[model samples]
Target chain A: MILTVTLNAALDITYKVAALTPHTTHRVGEVVERPGGKGINVARVLAALGHECVVTGFAGGATGAVLRGMLAPLAPHDALVEIAGTTRRTIAVTDGTSGDTTQLNEPGPTVLPEEWTAFLSSYDSLLRDADAVALCGSLPPGIHVGAYAELVRRARARQVPVLLDTSGEPLRRGIAARPDLVKPNADELAQLTGSREPLRATRDARRRGAHTVVASLGPDGLLATTPDGTWQAAPPEPVRGNPTGAGDSAVAGLLSGLVAGLSWPERLSRAVALSTATVLATAAGEFDAAAYERLLGRVTVVEHTQAASGK
Target chain B: MILTVTLNAALDITYKVAALTPHTTHRVGEVVERPGGKGINVARVLAALGHECVVTGFAGGATGAVLRGMLAPLAPHDALVEIAGTTRRTIAVTDGTSGDTTQLNEPGPTVLPEEWTAFLSSYDSLLRDADAVALCGSLPPGIHVGAYAELVRRARARQVPVLLDTSGEPLRRGIAARPDLVKPNADELAQLTGSREPLRATRDARRRGAHTVVASLGPDGLLATTPDGTWQAAPPEPVRGNPTGAGDSAVAGLLSGLVAGLSWPERLSRAVALSTATVLATAAGEFDAAAYERLLGRVTVVEHTQAASGK
Candidate 1:
């Protein structure tokens, strides 16, 4: 079973309004809610791919209950440790006219020290049956900055491959722990490597210690530098809808492929297709299965053999 | 005991952001949650004045649970009915830069036939001990348009004074049932009577069926046409802040003053002061007690002798 951790989970809410005008009241036309957080999102994608996955993290208070309640029927098994603070919420107001989205994100509840320790115990127990573990999203307040690094080290100790997906100091620290893989979007890569070039940034990120680095380039596609070689994968066309969960979908693809022992080229193809399909899907954290299937064979994966030259 | 029915109760959530910009993501700086809806707000204000108030409404699901949990410690008694549908949430995004608020209101849960029937039974039981009842706010989906009218008639039958506060068709239909009082803002008064003139509109509204008509003019204060006489009450100075719950505070002032056997002029004075104080308060459904006291003696109430022509 694949294991995913989301320390700062959320109840993702979408409000559909005729128009989002500042300084005025609006009666939302529709409300769509879903369980959200990076690792939860990745778990959802993996579950959609018919993989048995377990989601373990910190779930607390009313919003956390709502998120967990919504997740109960899904494929991923819930192993979340209880906490005292309520989970946060993320609201996206979609405008009918301009089709633009205005987002409001509430900070997650601060995890107590005891809560963090409880989560570590749960994670260790879950890792016992896990082939791969993923530590995803921002660290909720009260957790140590190197929380992901500790988790990565633990997973490596258990001989379970781990993927770290985060940003800022956590990413910097977690990457140094030499996780099996790290997926950072272009902006996050730039922040980490101080370089805007995807290929150079991915290489710089790998040198920071992950066994492999994958950079999601939004609409363009994925750039990866693995131990065996390097490859750039692009979709047949850019699919534009909501790019909210595209990166998590790519993470799911790569992690699932890694566990399935698929070739690196095949994994990149799957990752690219899944990422594009997620952007094309209407719902958050969901990929249009047919779109993924259609784009699968069409995804282009080109390998760069000049790895030693650092080009 | 005073009873307030918020057929469509809400979990009012306020988010403070640095600035409200359309089509951009915002990190909320602070989050405040309160039990809300017209009658709920009124109940909150009444409780603050040491009035024993009972709040009855449809509450369900996780959001409802949160609302109830928060309301548990408040002064008012909770006798809210349970339903299968989740209660709604209203988010007010206050911009720190401009201090302008943007609101997004979610439609309340659809009350089923059985749910409405259950609520009526609860209302009937509560009315047994109720000296007066206030039916406030919109009718949620699945509830009949004449729901408030029916409640008003029941309260009247029980010899319990009923105050109707709503807008559009609900107000129109409710008025014909002869509620003891109706408090509409300037916009609602104009909509009900097709007159922009407050005196004429208040009289017209009273003629439709309410024994007393009180129209709250934003910043300008209130105009009341009661059986004893007609009076216009204005604050000494306009206190500006958020007007979100000003009308509800007015309803609370009027209702509590009625129970206290205050005269028309005195009740109007209290209502105006409370309304203004609510606007000056920092939190939702709260009035500045000191400001209310300060503004009470300073409120100016002018009685118009030409009541017949409403000149």
Candidate 2:
């Protein structure tokens, strides 16, 4: 079973309205709520792909309880560490007429020192029975920047292949622990390496201690530099819809392929197909099975043989 | 003890931000949540005024549980009837720079037939010990528009003074049951009586079976046409701030004065002072005690002996 950790989980709420105008009253037409965070999203996608997954992280207060309750039916194993602060809610107000979305994100619950220690022990236990582990999302308050770095160290100690997906200082620090894989979006990659070019940034990220680096280029698709070789994967056509959970779906695809011992080309194909399918689906963290099946065989994967040569 | 019934209770959530722009993401600076609805707000204010208040109505689901948990410390009596459907949340996004608030209100939970019956029985038991009953807010779906009307009749049967606070069809139907008092703002009054003038509309509302009709005129204060006499109450100066719970505070002030057996002018003075003070306070349903005291002696209450000549 794959273990996913979400340091900052959220109760994702969506409000549908006719239009959103500042300082005006809106009668929301509908409310949709789901458990959300990078790891949870990945776990959801993995579960949909018939993979056994366990989710562990912080869950607290009323909103946390609601999130856990909602996650029960979706995820099989729940190993969340309870905290004192109430979990945060992320609201997205969608305009029905224009399809515009306004997002409001709360900073999420602050973790105490004991809560962090508690989580470390719980995560260690979960790692013992796990084939692979994923450390995802932002580090909550009171957690040091090296929190993911420490988790990566523990996973490496257990010889468990771990994937780290985060940005900024956490990403920089965690890479030092040499995680098996790190997936950063183009923007995150630029912010970390100060390079506008994706290939240069991916190589820089890999040199910082990531064994493999995958840079997501939005509609342009995935660019990966791994031990075997460098490869690029693109969809047949650009898919358009809510792209909220597309990245997490891609991570799930890569993780699934890695566990199944698929070739690099096959892994990239699955990742691109799943990512595109997720964008084509209605809700975040959900992909249409038919779309995934159809797109799987059509994804274009090309291997790049040219060395970086310090470019 | 005063019994306040919130047929449609809510978890009032306030999000503070630097500014509000459509279709953009906002990092909320702060979050404040409280149990809210017309009756719940009234009950909160009443509790602050040293009145023993019991809050009853549907409280269910995760949001309802959170509301009850928050209300536990503020309110002494919780006679809320449990339901199956989850409660609603009303989000107010306040722009700190402009001091403007954008509101998004979710339609409350649909009350099942069995839930309505359960609430009616609970209301009956509470009314036995209540000096006054306040039926407040809109009727949730699955409940009849005449829900408030039925509550008014029950209150009348128990010889408990009932205050009906709602709008549109429910208010119109509820007033037909001859509630002891009905407080309608300028817009609600206009909709109810089809009259533009406040005095004419107040008289029309009274004629429609409310024993007492009080028309809230926003910054202009209140115009009351009671069985004892007609009076106009205005604040010393127009108070300005958040006016979210000003009406509920006025309801609390009126109820307090009635229980204290104060004269109509004194009651009007208290209502005006409390309403103005609530606007001056930082949060809804809470009045600045010092401000209320200072404003109390300065509010102007004039007896209007000239009856409306069908204007």
Candidate 3:
């Protein structure tokens, strides 16, 4: 079973309108609601991939209740902790005319001291039955900065392979705990390493204590530096669609492949394919299955023989 | 006791931001949630006015639960019918920089046939114990176009004075049922009477079947045509703020004043004062008590010397 942790979950709502104009009233033509957070999104994709996954997180208030109800049927196991504060919500107003979207994110609730303690205990207990764990998204208010680092350390202590997907200080502190995998996009990589060059940034990330660092280069695909070797993977063609959850789909692909004992190249191919499929899907946090299957074989993974062959 | 019906109750959510830009992402600084619908807003003000108000309508799903929870301590009584469909939410994005607001209103939930029957039964039962009833807002889908009209007839059959506040076909049909009172703003009045002139339009609306008609004239205050006579009541000066629920506040004042056995001039003074106070309040569906008191004495009410005087 796979384990996923999301400290800050959201009820993702999308409102479709003819157009969005500032200071004007718009009657929404359609409303779409779903549960979202990086880890929750990853778990959704992983479940679609035929993996047994358990989702652990904090959920409270009306928004949280709606999210939990929606997630009940999606995830195999739910280990969400109850909190006193309300969960946040994100509204994506999509204009039907220009196919543009405006995002409004509510600030997450503050986690109480006992709530964080309770979450830590639950996460530790959930890790006992997990094959691999993925820690995803930003930390909600009142949570420690080194929260990911502590989780990564705990997962390692339990001999569980963990993947960390976050940015800024969380990613920096998390990598120092030496997680098995870390996937950071170019902007996050540049923020962490202060290097505009993808290759240099990717290598510098791995040296920061991450066992393996996969830097997502947006349209250019992914550059991965690992103990075995360095590899570059790219989709045959860029898929044009909503890119909101493409990275989470990539994390799902990589995490699922690791649990299935797929090689680094195979994982990279699957990750790139799933990400492109997610981009092709019309709705956010969903992948085009047919596209994923078709692109899986079309994805190209090449080994970089110039990099250090520590293996 | 006052019975107010909001067939399409909503969970009104407001998001505060520094600025609003279309097709751009924003982080909301704060969120404020409340129960809203025309009648619900009226009930809120009536409850604040020390009236025993029983609110009845349809409420369902998670949004309904949240709305009911927020309204439990608000209204004197909760008699909202349960339904299968989820209640809708209205989002108001307030831009702090320009003091502008962008509104996004979700279409109300469709009322099931059985649910409509249930509401009618509950409303009839509640009206038996009521001095007056208010049938408010747009009819949700699946409800007959004459929904308000039917409700008005029922209230009249029980000798319960009913005030209807709606627009378009609903207002046209509801007025023909001879509701005790109908409050239509300038636009609704014009649509119903096909007359641009306020005095002529207000009189025309009364001839169509409403016992009395009160036309809200924006900054021009209110024009009332009733059995006693016609009168114009205006605030001393224009009190500027959000006008979202100003009319609903007027409806509350009118109903409450009628139940308190106030004279026409006194009722008009209270209505105009409450409406002005609602505008003075920073938040919607709220009246400034101090301003209401101050403005109550300052409001001017003069009876029209030449008008329909059958009374």
* Predicted complexes: DockQ each: 0.92, 0.90, 0.84
**lDDT per residue as tens, model 2, A179-279:** 99999999899999999798888999999999999998999999999988888899999878988888998999999998889998898899999999999
All candidates: TM-score: 0.98, 0.97, 0.96
Ranking by TM-score: 1, 2, 3
Q: How accurate is candidate 2 locally (lDDT)?
A: 0.91
Which residue pairs show backbone clashes in model 1?
Answer: none
**Candidate 3 C-alpha lDDT tens digits along B96-190:** 88778899999989889999998888888898899999989988888999999999999999899999999999999999999999999999999
* Predicted model with the maximum TM-score: 1
Question: How many clashes show up per model?
Answer: 0, 0, 0
Candidate 2 lDDT, tens digit per residue, B10-43?
9999999999999999999899998889999998
Docking class of 1: high
Order of all candidates by lDDT, from best down to worst?
A: 1, 3, 2
Q: Which stretches of candidate 1 lie over 4 Å from their true place?
A: A307-311, B307-311
The per-residue C-alpha lDDT of model 1 at residue A118 equals 82
For model 2 the local lDDT of residue B211 reads 100
